[model samples]
Structure formats: C-alpha cells, structure tokens
Target: MSRIAYVNGRYVAQRDACVNIEDRGYQFGDGIYEVVHLYDGRFIDADLHLARLERSVKEIRLGMPMPLASLKLVLAEVARRNRVSEGLLYMQVGRGVARRDHAFPNTPVPVSLVVTVRRVPPYPSSLDGWSMSAITHPDLRWARRDIKSVNLLPNVLARQAAREAGAGEAILFDPATSMVTEGAATSFWIVDAEGSIRIPPLGPTILPGCTRAAMLAEMAEHGMRAEERPFSLDELAKAREAFITSATSFVKPVLAVDGKPVGDGKPGPVARRLFEIFARHVKGAPRNALQ
Candidate 1:
C-alpha cells in the first residue's frame, strides 16, 4: 500500500506531498519538527511530544496550523491509514510559501503542517547484544537548540562522521568548555562511579528529549536519584556506564567511546536495569512492578 501523509489540510500520498519552493522551511530551515515513537498501536509519551511541538512553534514565532486537539485527530488518522504500529510519526510545521526575502512575510501566511508515519522494527525487549560504540565530536550548532527546528546540518555532518568512524552515534561536546552536551540526535547520559544517573542540565545547549524525561520520571518513581549536571569529557571517560536516549533509539547502552571501553567495555548492570524499566513503562506495566 502507498504510504499516506497529512500535508497542510489534506491527507495525501507521501510520494506526492510537496511544499512550494519558496516555503521558508525549504529556503531557510525556518521550521520545527517532532518525532513520536509509536508502540503497540499507541503513541508513547504523546502528550509530552505535543507539548514540545506547541513550545517549538512559540519559540519560532509560528502559529500552530491547527488546534492541538484537531492535530491529534490527524495523527490518529494518518497512523490508521498507514497501519503502522511500531513506527515513527514525523511532523514538520513551516512558515508557508512566500516571496524570496529572508524576513518574515510582510503579510502573515498560513503555516505549513505535514505529518507522516512509517514502520520500524519492534523495540528491543533485552539488551543482550544491544551495546553500541560512539565517537566524540564537537558541538557546532546554533545556540537555540532548545527549539526542535529543522536546522540540522551540523548534526548531519557529525553523525556522518560517526558512521565513517564505525560508530553508531556521535556524542557531541562543547569545545570551549570541554563539557558534553548531547548526541548528534539523542540525549546523552552516564552512570557515574558514585552510582548516580547523570544527564546534562536542560538549557540552550541541547534539545530536551521526551524519552529522557520519561526515563527520569521512571527512575524517580522507583527511588533512583538522577542528577542533572554536566559532565566533562574526562568524567565521561571514567563513567561506570553510558547510554543515549531518543524517540527511536529508546534507551541504548553505549559500551565504548573513541574506540576505548567505558567501564568494563560492556553493557553495565545499571543500563540493563534502566532499559528494562523503560521497556516496562512503554508497555504500560504497573509502576510498582517496575522495580
């Protein structure tokens, strides 16, 4: 079956969906996007994702194309049309077509909205061969990363560099401060020697991740303490275990960085337990049963 996409105000074929060439998003990357993980025919953490979507439009000075309640219906319709259970729902909202000048159009134009879904493999239930290797790269994006904008050239380059280095992801750090910010596309975290869960504090340096937030809540509910503090490269090198989280990758263990083993060079106990906890949360298992 041909994939279906919700473009602007209509449901259309994904292959034929198009935005005008002068669309601000196409010309200046003047748009925001969000990816929500679909699990077992449900949108996992959807409220969080939609909340972020609302925030992104506000940050970028674009009006929401439609009310969120209406958008939710569109999301459900698109998902049903494609019959995607385990997949990603991608939404992009852009300043609609305008004349070729850089500034916002003198007259307000309708914001563009496009939503699509595609199938992906089921989320892993175990970490038994799930360890990944990563490479460190300099964080070279603009400062307003808090907004989930489509401006991702720097991330694309960094991730491509990681792929060329035979690594699964790129852990990007601030060159001047020597502090780890996040991954090319995921949120970074570490289990320190003190057995604490540490993630970089929320700010302009990183895109706050939905999965990262959910995992932190899960940890808190289970009596686990998580510290939102930045860790330097040296600290990262000495971590007991490291992992990255995102909508698609979920909770993935990182066993090595820059070709060197982190901790025992294996998926540590903490990461394995966290993975199970998050998997249970995704499956809607009772919170008390998570421990």
Candidate 2:
C-alpha cells in the first residue's frame, strides 16, 4: 500500500508529495523537525515531543505552521491513514518558499509543514545477549546543537563513519576539551563505578533529548539518581557500563566502544535494569499519562 503524507495542509500520496524548490528548508536547511513514537495507536510522550517541537521552532525563529491543537489532529489523521500502530511520526516545519537567498525572505510567508508516518518493529523484549558497538568521533557540529535543526551534515558524516567502522553509533567528543557531547542521533549515558547514572549537562553542544528526559524520570522513580556533568573520554572508558537513548531506541546497551570492551564486555546489570524499567514505563502508562 502506498503511504500517505500531510504536506502544506493537504494529505497526499507520499510519492506525490513535494515542496517548492525555493523552500528555505530545501535550499538552506532552515527548518526544525520532531519525531514521536507510537505504541498501540497511542503517541508515546506526545506532550513532551510537542513541547520540544515548539522550542525548536522558536529557537530557529520560524513561525509554527499551525496551532498546536491542529498539528496534533493532523498527526493523528496521518497515523490513522497510514495504519501506523507501532511506528514513528515525523514532522518538519520550514521557513517557507521564497526566491533563492541566504537571508530570510523580507516579505512574510506561511511556514511549510510536512508530516509522514511509517511502521517500525516493536522494541526488543530483551537486550540480554544483544549489544551495540560505537566509535568516538570529533564533534564537528555547529555550536547551536541544542536546536533540532534540519542541518545535519556533520551528524550524517559521523554516522556514516561509524557504519564504515562496523559500529552502530558514533559518540562525538569535543576536540578542545575531549568532553563527550552525544551520539550522532542518540543521547549518551554511562553507569559510573558507584552505580550512578552520568550524563552530560544541558549545553549548546547537545540536543535536549526527550527520551533522555524520560529515562531520567524513570531512573528517579526507581530510586536511581543521575548526575548531569561532563565526563571525558577517559572517564567513559573506565565506566562500568554505557547506553544511549532516543525516540526510536529507548534504552540500548553499548557493550563496546572503539573495539574496546566496556564493563566485562557485556551488558551490565544497571543497563539491563534501566531497560526493563523504561519498557514498563512505556507500556504501562497511558498515552496522556505524561501530559
């Protein structure tokens, strides 16, 4: 079956969907995007995702294409039309089409909105024996990494580098300080020797991840405290365990980094426990529970 997409306030076949060539998003990558995960036809962390979307749009100085309520309805309709029960909903808002120019168009123009949905396999029941390897790369992204912008060349390159190196992710670190920033598409976390969760503090170098926030809340609920402070590459190497969080991969364990084993070269107890806790949190809570 052909998939459907919402483009510029119209629902159309995905293949037939198109935006103007002069659209700032297409021309200069001036846009922001958000992705929400769906489980059993319900949006997981819809409120948080919407909040982040708004924040990103504001950060980029672009007007919202539609009101929040209308956007939510559009997303729901797209998901329904595509029959996406367990999948992802992606939304992109651009500065609108105008003559090819580096600066923002002088005249006011309506922001462009596009949304698409696709099915994804359910989360694994157990990462018991499964693990992912990651490679570290120099953080070469713009300073405003906090914004969820459409510009992702550096991230794309880093991810490709990881793929070529037979790894699933690339953990980016600052060249100046060697402080770990984040993954190409995921938020990084480590379990320290004292069994405490350590994550980098909010800064311009890292995007504020919704899944990372949810994981922190889950950790708190389970009586585990997370430290939000910068950890260096040396620190990560000696950490007891490590993992990454994202809208897609909830709590994935990282057994190795740069071909070196982490924590006995296996998924550790902390990561396993957190994964179970996160799974339960997502499954047991109602769609609006977080709202």
Candidate 3:
C-alpha cells in the first residue's frame, strides 16, 4: 500500500507531494513542526500537542495556514490515509513560498502545510530503560530556543555524536554555565535522593516536551512530587536516577551519561514508577493489574 500525505489543501501520495523550492521552510528553515505519538488508535496527548502547535506558530509569527479544527481534521485524514493505527503524525508549517531572499516576503504568503503519517514500532512495553551519552557541544542556535523551529543542524550533529558513541540519546550541556539543558530531541530530568522529580523550567535552553508535562500530572496522581528548576550537570551525574522524555520515546530512563553509571548503573525506582504510571495512563486499561 502506498503511503499518503496531505500537502496544503490537497491529499496526495507521499512520493507525489512536493512543495515549491522557494518555500521558506526549505529555503531558510522558517517553519515549526510537531510530532505526536499514538497508542490504541488515539493520540497520546493530543490537547497538549495541539496547544504547543499553537504556541509554536505564535512564537514564530507563522499563521496556521488553516483553522486548528480544520488542521486536526486534515491530520486525522492523513493518519487514516496512511493506515497508521499506531505510529507518529508529523505536521509542519512554513512561512509560505516567497522569492529567493533572506527577509520575510512583503505580500501575504500562503502558509505551506504538510501532514504525513508513518508507522512506528509499538512503544516499548517494559521500558526497562535505555542508556545514553552526552557529547558537549557549543550552543550555536538562535537565542529563542523555545520555539520548535526546523533549523536543527546542531541537534543533528549532536545526535550523530551520540550514535557514534553508541548511545541512544545525546544530552547537551551549556559549556558556559555547565548546566544540563535537555537531550538533543527529548527533555531531560533527574530524580534526586529526596525523591523529587526535577526538570529544567521552560527556557531558551530546553524544548518543552508534551510527554514531560503529561508525566508531571501522572506524578501527582501517582503520589510523586514534581519540581521545575535547573540543576548542575554534577547533580545529574550524582542523582538517584535520570531519564529523558519525548513524544516518540515517551519516558526512557537513562542509566548512564558519558559512559559513567548513574546511581547503581540501573534504571532508578523513580523513573521506573513514572514510566509505569505513564504507561497506565496512556494504555487506558486500568494499570494492567500486574507487571
């Protein structure tokens, strides 16, 4: 079966869906994107993802080419067209097509939109946790790091470094401040000895993750404390447990950083608890009654 994609107002085959070369997203990386995970044929956290989509558009001054309701319809249509019962939906919006120039186009340009769905392996059941590495790199992006923009050169390179280093994710640290911000593609967190779940607050340093927020609520329901603040890289290395969260990975525990064991070189209890709660919340089957 051929995969389908939605381009602008038209539904087309993925191979046939093409955008103009002058599209700002392609030309200048002037676009924002969102990735949402699906389970049991339902979006894991649709509302949060949608809210972030709106935030991204507002931050970048890029009008959502269509009303959000219409966009959701298009997204569902795209998911159905690709037969993606369990997978990811990727949607992007660009500043639209304009002549080859650096500045924004003067006249109103139609916001270019593309929605694609792809089948991903089922999210892990156990989430026994995975190990990752951190390769320090200069923070070389624009000041507004809060926006989910498409200019991901630094992240691409950093992820490559992690891959080559034989790690699952790359956690980046600010060289100047020596504070851990987040993973190349996920939000980082640490569970302290006091049983507090710590994640850096929203800033130019971290991409606010939807799963992370969901887990915060899950924490409260599961009888855990949530803290939003920054901690040192040293604190992370010495913390009780560490993990990263994203729309795709959900909640992946990080047992090591820079080839050193975090805590007992095993998935910490706090992270494991969050993972369990998250799974129960998204799985929607009343906690499985057994593990």
Candidate 4:
C-alpha cells in the first residue's frame, strides 16, 4: 500500500509531501520530533509521547502548530490512511518558514507540522535467540540533548560508525569523563553484577526517553531495585547484561559490546524479564502507572 503523510495543514501522498525550502527545520534544524508506537491499532503511551513533544517544543522556543489534541487526531488519521496497525508514527514540528536569517522572523509565522507512519515487525514474545551488539563512541552532541531536536548529524555519524563496525547500535560516552551517556538513538541500561538495574540520570547530557521512563515505572511497580546513577565505561565492561530501549526497538538485549560477550554473550534473565514487563505494560498498563 502507498504511504500517506500529513504535511502542514493537509494530507497527501508520502512521496508528494513537501514543505517550504525556507522552513527553519530544513535550514537551521530548529525543530523537535517524536516517534509514537502503534500496537493493535492503539497508541502506546500517547500521553507520555505528547508530553515530551510539548516539552521539546517549549525548550526550542518554537510554537506548537496546533493544540496537542488536534495533533493527535492528525496522527491517527495519518496512521489510518496508511493502514498501519503495527508501526511507528513520526511527527515533526518546525519554527515555520521565513526569509534567510539566523534570527527568528520579525513577523509571526505559523509553525510547520508533519506526520507520517511506517510499518514494523510485530513485537517479539521472547528473546530466546535474539542477538544485538553495540560499539562505544564519543558523545559529540550538543549540551541540550534533553531536547528532541532535529540536530542529529552527530548521532547520524555515530550510528554510521556502529553500522560500519558490524554492530546494531552505538553506545555513546563522554570523551572527557569516560562515562556512558546513552546510545546514539536509544536509552542505555545495564544489569550490574549485584543484580541492580542502572540507567544514567536524566540531564542535559541525554534525552529523556519515553520508553525508559515507562520501563522504570514498570520496574517500580514490581518492586524492582533501579538506580538512576551514571555508569562509567569500566562499569559497562563489567556489567552482567546490557540493553537499549526506544520507541521502535523497545527493550532489546545487547548480547555483546565491542565484539566481546556480555555475561556468556546471551540475553540475560534480567533483560528478558524486563522485556516481558515492558511488553505487558504497553499492552494494558494504566496511564497513571507511568509515573
């Protein structure tokens, strides 16, 4: 089936969707984006995704193209038009078109909005034979990684490096501190030797991942011990297991790092259990349960 896209104020063929060349998102990368997961024709964690989009829009000093309520409707329509029952919905908001200039336009301009959807494989029911790997790379992104902006050149480069290295993801670390920040496009987590789940604290150094937050809440609901402390490269090397989370990847186990096996080079029990918890949470967890 041909894909459909919502561009600005109208729905059009995905191939025909276009924005002004002078749009700030195209010229200066002055925009934010969100990727929402669709499962069984229902949006997973819609509240969290929209909340983060709102936060990102505010941080970038860009106006929302329309009320979030209206944006949700657009996203639903886009998904429906594409006949995507299990896929990802991508949304981007830009600071609108303007004359070539570094400064914001002297006159108000309506923000640019785009929404599209694409299909993905169904969620896995087990990690019995699944294998994924990662390689360490320097975090060369800006200090405002907290914002989900479109400035992703550094991430693109890092992910490309990982691809060339025959790895599935790039685990990024601070060059100066030798501390693990996150993956190029996913939240990084580890199961330490003592069996504690560890994720780096949220700050300017990393994006506040919606999947990470939901996973943490699920863990908490089960009375699991989770720490929000930064883990160094040395600590990661010694981890019992490692994994990466994102809207699309969900809770994926990283069986190896830098070509070395992690805890027998297999998916650990902790990761499997976490994956099960997250999968169940996505299917039917209460909205208030996502604290």
Least accurate 10 contiguous residues by lDDT in model 1: 282-291
After aligning candidate 3 to the native by TM-score, how far in Å is the CA of 153 from where it should be?
0.8
Once superposed on the true structure, which residue ranges of model 1 sit more than 4 Å away at CA?
285-291
Candidate 3: regions farther than 4 A off: 129-138, 285-291
Off by over 4 Å in 2: 287-291
The parts of candidate 4 lying over 4 Å away from their true place are 286-291
Q: How does candidate 4 fare on TM-score? A: 0.97
Clashes of 4: 0
Residue range 104-200, candidate 2, lDDT tens digits: 8999899999999999998688987557999999999999999999999999999999999999999999999999999999999998776778999
Angstrom error of the Cα, residue 62, model 4: value is 1.0
Task: Give the per-residue lDDT digits (tens) of candidate 4, residues 153-184.
Answer: 99999999999999999999999999999999
Clashing pairs in 3: none
> Each candidate's lDDT (Cα)?
0.91, 0.90, 0.81, 0.90
Candidate 1 clash total? 0
Q: How well is each residue in 1-291 modelled by candidate 3, as lDDT tens digits?
A: 889999888999898989999999998999999997767667778888888889998988878888877887888888877778788889998999889888889898899999898998886788553445454444555677788999899889888888888888887778788887888888988887666778988887678788888888788876888889888777877788888889887778787788887788787777777777888878884422111
TM-scores of the candidates are 0.97, 0.97, 0.94, 0.97
Native-structure RMSD, model 3: 3.6
Better of 1 and 4 by lDDT: 1
Better of 2 and 3 by lDDT: 2
List RMSD in Å for every model shown.
Answer: 2.9, 1.3, 3.6, 1.9
Cα RMSD for candidate 4? 1.9
